[model samples]
Target: MKIFRLTFFLVLISQLALAQTKRNIDHQSLTWIRYYNILPLTEKWALHSEIDNRNFIDPICQNVFVLRVQGRYRANKNIDLGGGFAYFNANTQNPNNNPDYSVPEYRLQQDVTLINDIAKITFHNRFQVEERFIQKANATELLDDYSYAWRFRYRLQATFTLWEKEKQSLKGSISDEVMFNLGKDNTKNTFDQNRIYGALRYAFNPNIHLELGYLKSFQRRASGIDFYDRDIVRFTVYHKINRKTKA
Candidate 1:
């Protein structure tokens, strides 16, 4: 767990340094509820889908709803390749002081994932590239135009078994994900965000599981001078066709 400790420390340092450098910041609390599914059609091909809903709490305001679908190819025992499309209906708290209306975004993404196990501890490395088409918006609200952007993201996650019982087990996981925006449009906030998280997972069986997690999200705004520091509570459900042993 040295890697987790070191990475967590470095991330804390970065957050502190950012607080010192940026004066304009917004604090928000959020909740995310998600459902994820994976099904295998053949020995090598699989389908993955997700439904995610995000909301701002305290006053309980709408934030975003996300839908994703992907087709995966099992490249080898340790690797997988996937490509997918996603849709986002999102609202912002910028100009209106509250979320007035929702806007739309379409995204295409490609991903590569690697998995390894050491003494029952599992490590996951995921790399992704996304092409985003976001609906344009003014200070007041969304406009009719759309803009294009691209970004790359990487996540490192580790999971370990905590306890076991008959047909049930508990697992703990920690993960860190970083995103960087690319292209000429990024003048102010090229550094998108960083998410550091941990979760407790309970498996009823091999194909069904549940998780409750929390994360600190540090996101740079398009204004370049401002940032958003958010605390997010996440709950997720997993339904799989024996995701690990199916093949």
Candidate 2:
């Protein structure tokens, strides 16, 4: 009985220690919502828009908004290629920085899909270039400095239908990405970051879906401060518009 009591006490203490450790690391909570739509302008051409709003409660990033516009060419049933421009606005209201930052970016992406009797797989690849401009200064500088960089990201996902009549499906996905700096002497601001995510998705209907997943991200700074970690749970939702059903 004495040994059992000691073991129980040790377990309780370990749990408390873990909880304290997690509290020490800075935690950021984020909520995001996006709207995507495709408009058919002609026989072979389409216009697309993506608007996203994200809020961060962490010390690093407070609030951010992203917007993008793209033109797509549907070459066939299994492939799509698009080019777009994006703008990002960041609000640095926290005590970490003296000025806020905003950036304008450009991107090109391609998508492909393969469907079979058992399952379906999709791939999306994006290449982006960005120029960052500083804003809301606390100092006496008349103009802000600008920097340019590029990034590449790829995502692969597969889905298997469990009940074809009910549209119930199981899905999994993985993503990999890297960023690089360009057009200057070497600086610590120019580093690379990578991320990988795996998720399971459920389809409520042909037009809407939901996902729950885990993500692992890493950042390698030129100043030798490299950090990597994993996220416990992430949620995602997707919605598509069908013109045939609308009419």
Per-residue lDDT over 124-198 for candidate 2, one digit per residue giving the tens place of the 0 to 100 score: 444444443333233443245444444433333344433445665666666554454543432542434445667
* Whole-model lDDT per candidate: 0.86, 0.51
Clashes of each: 0, 0
Native-to-model Cα distance after best TM-score fit, residue 242 in candidate 1, in Å: 7.0
What tens digits encode model 1's per-residue C-alpha lDDT throughout 90-125? 876542266466789999999998888989989988
* Candidate 2 error regions (>4 Å): 1-31, 40-44, 57-61, 93-120, 123-142, 154-170, 185-191, 221-234, 244-247
In terms of lDDT, model 1 sits at 0.86
Candidate that scores best on lDDT: 1
